[model samples]
Target: MDIKRSYKGAVEISVILLFTVMIFSCGKDTPGTIEPEKKNEKWRTTAVKDSIGNQYYVVNTLDNKLEIRVDNKEGKTIFAEVCPTIDPAEIPSEAAMVITGVATPNKYISINDATLVLKIVMDDVKIQKKYIQLLANINLDTKKFYTKKYKIEKPEDWTIVDYNNVVHWYQNTLLVREGTDYDLNRGGGFMGLGQRGTQLVCYERDFTIRYTKDIDANLASYPSGSGGQYIPINNFEDMAFRSDGLISRVQIVTSVEDEWAGKKDIVWQNDLKKSSNIPADYSVRITDYNIQGDEVIASYTIFDEKGNVKYKRTGKWALSNGFPRGYTTE
Candidate 1:
């Protein structure tokens, strides 16, 4: 009987030990626990090739750093750089960045056969409600890097509007839109009331990297004595971009008092003088415009208060010198 009890106790102990081992093994495989192999796994990886058969690999590590590798056509590792954290998914395949008020696409990272341009946004802890935008241009041929930094203010109430497809990279020039909000009050004393509206601003930055406010126009306006009503006619129209992504031309409606005052002179201005190097005397009221090769053809019209088209003429301007010499108006 002693031998039998001893054997049974040993068997029970063995079974308990086996069960405990199984429980511990299952616990290790539970949802919250990280497997040994996956502990060092990467968050994401992206691989792309440029036009000249240069291979590029972008890896997003678990700690939010980007590991970028470039290989030449001969499969030789030519360049490698570790950049700040930017989600691999945000980078677009195209060369242009489109900020449509809702989301800013990864076109911020543009890679071409000769150059790689990166637009990075960094927070500024030193300044309240401000941020820094860094533009890094890398020459793939020479492996040289150049950087431009822009300090931008962050407004609490303003928002980005896709705003006629604003923001583009025109060769060495950059065009971007900045939006602002304004409060307008109509009437006087106790009967006065206030309204809010957004102003869409178009800014141009040349190769010198200086920002110029090209157009400061509103999306809508609440005219005084109009009972806080909004009108959309006082906005930008016919924004056209060149083949190289430059805002070739834009038309601004200075006022829409014609809607209320019966007969108001509607002025249309061509705001591309500085960018295109056009002369200031060039007529701003261009009606129809087209860009063909290196020349720009535009039409102008003059109308009487009775809505009669009094005069119509067409002119051709050269983009090379911004002169109306090659072509004549009809």
Candidate 2:
């Protein structure tokens, strides 16, 4: 009977020890134990095509990172990049959330031939208080990626006026934002009469990104008591690009009035290797004579502010050499 009791007690103790071990295992108190957060590990992939039929595969790693891949016409991988992750806590959430006139939840907003614009938003319930809006511009050919953060309040008040490569030969994107000029001084010192204008934010590119506040203008003298007047002269006007993605010609309004303006048209020479300015008022029209073998023969006519013909010129430009021969001037 004693041996039987001892054996029974030993069996019970073993069972109890097993149950205790099971309880401890089920709990999260084990040494070096960690519970993985599966939500953060979730990710999604999206594919987009550009205007030129290039394929772009974007993978939102869901960890504040993006994996991008670009494929060319033959489905050959041309470029790939793994963008650096951003800290959600460091981003501000109070600003506006509208992009390109629409409130988007994380997605590609624009896809040019060689550029991609992505809008990344982190507004999950867990991170609603720490919401973040990031605009990323990725260049497939240059293998460059840049990001900018915006905090806007009103959606209807702001608009993206222009977003594209002003000069196709140059791999830079020009972004123009149209909104209310909040500076009371710009509105003739009034509240509701704020000036509505466009601001040149920056040139998105791999290198040499330029930031400008407003268009280049002149401050005209005003009466001693009043603020000076702002007169916008040198403004970006019409431009043309060659079939080979080179700058053909660009016209700039040098003066508000053509009476005093000179050299208002810039013609790209030598396949855009050099530039020549037309010594006259702004160009009224441009005509392409011929394009062959890295050479462009073009003609343009400039007119004065009074609609009178000021100058006319015809030139042949080549990529290998600047104006190979003398051009005709009228």
Candidate 3:
């Protein structure tokens, strides 16, 4: 009897141990309740102001750091830097910084040198900052190269205007190509073509620069051609020249053998109107015209249809992408 009781107690103990082991094993094997390893969901991000503002889309990878910068009225870049992409909401309200920048969360970001108003969202919290950086670089003479973060939106004439009358077209603003007239003095016969933002390239040297609206930045550039954008060069006509040395109108005479369309295409003719030069403090000059890397300036005069002067603005001429070395006469 004693031996049987001992045997039964051992059996009961073994069963209890087995049942406990099974219960623990079942807890570990449950599928739905298993926890997954933590991962980062911050990838593939974008900054959308009201779903329609300038979107700073993150590019292919997120390993790159953010670049912030500030530029003057011209498209020249100023100071730039790399920073951690923190949630703007996490920044202290008393934090001192300037951060006017566009963000591409997947890739990087670039900003101008100015006191910016940034509303950053990180971890579902919005943080704001002021005095993010030094704002005096606008007048600085520095040529800084920044990683182009902003994917320039193609310019559409009809879709981008504000009640205050601000136009934000940023693509194909100017075209540049090899100049037909080669100068022995200048090594590269490179001439830039400024034109209406519609076409990608300028076929001929004669073209018109139409600012869709009043852009007071006194913008200028030695426009360059794109990698593959072709331009039509048919139908040439002689147009009148404005008071300035630029052509007021041009005549397009279609070549018998159209480079674009073989066989004498439709004989097309178009007329150009005179471009009213607004009073500006900068003069648009051909590339290499200014020899001094430190000394070049131009002026502009904005006038109304009646030829009445409306406004006069001034900008420093920069030969080497640095600060304006000089200015133009009024």
Candidate 4:
């Protein structure tokens, strides 16, 4: 009887221990590990009106920083709450620090525009210190407008040549390629209808430059090309932005015999893209040019087979794959 009772007690104790172990194993996940929280890194633009009813663009960053950029002023940032600490003694109202850039969340503080108006509002206390610091960069009357002329030297002894300018502000690189094609009938002189072919090669050169004036501090460049983003410009007015963008792509159907059609298959290396058959005699020229914010506006005249102006167009230059293809107005 004593042995029977001892066995029963041992079995009961083992059962209790096993149940406790199972319970502990099941509860292990509750406190053993933790999941981290994800952060939103998108930056957005906000617009707010100041005490005097002037509007501006203000950006609130993810890390509790505020960026203020003006159209013609130097940009300012408040990295810490105490650094841009607004003193209540100079307080005007509760709307001063409220920044309204664009409601859309994006990294750029400005609203897809060269011109931005930002207002800061926080408890109606004006973040005037930051605004005033940034404002002085624009209000200086000593600023002047300047222009740089790009001198593209025409190769003196080329048979036919074409010129194009590639302006990529984002890359800080300007590329110019001169496509020259020369045809020669050699080895048979005059009447043999000698081996004829079109020779094509594009001489590419870099023309990107930096502005040497103090005004460069007031200007801004756009981000990478994502298609359909305009580098705006109005031809009739003075430009306040970086540049006037231009891209022209015309359908050229050309049928040249012998050398050109026969040799290397006639390759085009410049901005002039052949839609169909591009003859070796077509030429394009740009006359009036203007750079506005986000768009390149210009006037171009195309010379056809007989050297007369085939057509003249005025509008925004079109782009393909971050490079200008032709003229576009829409």
TM-score: which candidate is best? 2
* Tens-place lDDT digits, model 4, residues 65-153: 54443332233321112114323332223333443321111112122222111223222232121221111011112221111121112
Q: What TM-score number comes out for model 4? A: 0.19
True-structure RMSD for candidate 4? 23.9
TM-score of each: 0.31, 0.38, 0.20, 0.19
Please list the C-alpha lDDT of all candidates, in the order they appear: 0.38, 0.41, 0.27, 0.30
* Candidate 4: worst-modelled 10 consecutive residues by lDDT: 131-140
Best by lDDT: 2
Candidate with better lDDT, 3 vs 4: 4
Residue 274, candidate 1: alpha-carbon lDDT: 43
225-252 per-residue lDDT for model 1 (tens digits): 1111111111332224232212233333
Of candidates 2 and 1, the better by lDDT: 2
Worst 10 residues of 3 by lDDT: 160-169
Ranking by lDDT: 2, 1, 4, 3
Residue-wise lDDT of candidate 3 within 69-151, one digit each (tens)? 43333434333443333333333332122223331111001122111123222222232111121111111223322221111
Tell me which of candidates 2 and 3 scores higher on TM-score. Answer: 2
Give the C-alpha miss distance for residue 327 in model 3, angstroms: 69
